[model samples]
Target: MPVVSRFLGIIIAMYWDDHAPPHFHAKYAEYEITVNIRTGVVEGKFPKRALRHVLEWYEIHREELIENWELCQNDESPKSIEPLE
Candidate 1:
C-alpha cells in the first residue's frame, strides 16, 4: 500500500490492483478501515473521532481519491493528497 495522505495521526493509503468497489484505506493507531470511494461505506474499525476526520477528508478529496484509484489500478504511483486541517 502506498500512502496518499496523512492527518491527525491518521494515515491514508491505497493498494495497487486492490479489491473492488473503488476504496481506500484509513489507519489510525491500531485501527484500520477501508472506506468506499463513492459511497463512504467502511469496513473494519476505527475510533469515532478519527473516523469523522477520515470521512471529512474523504468528502474533501473524493475526486482526487478516484483519480488515485485509477492510477493505482494501472500500477502507477499515487499522488499525495492534502491532509485535513
Candidate 2:
C-alpha cells in the first residue's frame, strides 16, 4: 500500500492492482475504511469527525484520486495528493 495523503490524523492510501469500484483506503487511529472513488460508498469505519474530514478532502481531490487509482492499477508509483488544510 502507498500513502497518498494524510491529514487530521487520517492516512489515505491505495494498493497496487487493487479491486473494483476504484477506491482508496483510509485509516484513522483504530478506525479504517475503504471509500469508493466514484460513489462515496465506504466499507469500514471512522470517527464521525475523521470521516467528515476525509469526505471533504475526497470531494476536493476526487480527480486526483482517480488518477492515482489508474496509476496504481498499472503498478506505477502514485503521486502524493494534497492533504486537507
Candidate 3:
C-alpha cells in the first residue's frame, strides 16, 4: 500500500491493486479500515477510538477522495483533495 497521507496515528493510503467497491485503506498500528469514499461508509473493522477522526476526515473530503480513486483506477496518479464546493 502506498501512503497518501498521515496525521496523528492515522495513515491514509491506497493499494496499487485494490478490490471492488473502490475505497481507501486506513491504518493506525494494527487497526485497519477500508472506507468507502463515495458513500462515507466503513467497509471493514476499525478501532472505535480511531473511528471519530476517521469519519471526520472522510466527511470533510469524500468527494475528492472518490475522484482520486477514479484517477487511480485509470492508472493516473491520485490528485490532492480539493475543497468541497
Candidate 4:
C-alpha cells in the first residue's frame, strides 16, 4: 500500500492490490481504521477513540477518495490525497 495522505495524526492509504467494498486505511497514533470510501462506514477494524478524525477526513474527501480507491483496485495509478493545509 502507498500512503495517499498524511497529516498531524492521520495517515491515509490504499493498497496497491485490494478487494472491494471500496475502502481505505487510516492510521492515527496507535490506532487504525479501514473505512468504506462510498458510505462513510467503517468496514473493518477501528478503535473507538480514533474514529472521529477518520470520519471527519472521510466526510471531506469521500468522493475523491473513492475514485482513488477504485483506481487502486484496478491496478491503475491513482491520484494521491492532498493535505488541507
TM-score of each: 0.97, 0.97, 0.81, 0.80
**Candidate 1 local lDDT, residue 61:** 98
Cα lDDT, model 2, residue 44: 83
What digit string (tens of lDDT, one per residue) describes model 4 on residues 1-85?
6888887667888896887788888887667778877777775565564676677777888889878977887887778777645
Give the per-residue lDDT of model 3 (tens digit) for 5-69: 67768888876557678799888888888888777778677778687778887888777777778
List where candidate 2 sits over 4 angstroms from the true fold. none
Model 4 stretches astray by more than 4 angstroms: 43-49
Candidate 3: clashing residue pairs, number: 0
Q: What lDDT score is found at residue 84 in candidate 3? A: 19
Ranking by lDDT: 1, 2, 4, 3
Q: Which ten residues in a row have the lowest lDDT in candidate 3?
A: 76-85
Worst 10 residues of 2 by lDDT: 42-51
**Candidate 4 or 2, higher TM-score:** 2
Task: Report the poorest 10 consecutive residues by lDDT, candidate 1.
Answer: 17-26
For model 2, how does the per-residue alpha-carbon lDDT over 56-83 read when each residue is reduced to its tens digit?
Answer: 9999999999999999999999999999
Ranking by TM-score: 1, 2, 3, 4
In order, the Cα lDDT scores of the candidates are 0.96, 0.94, 0.75, 0.77
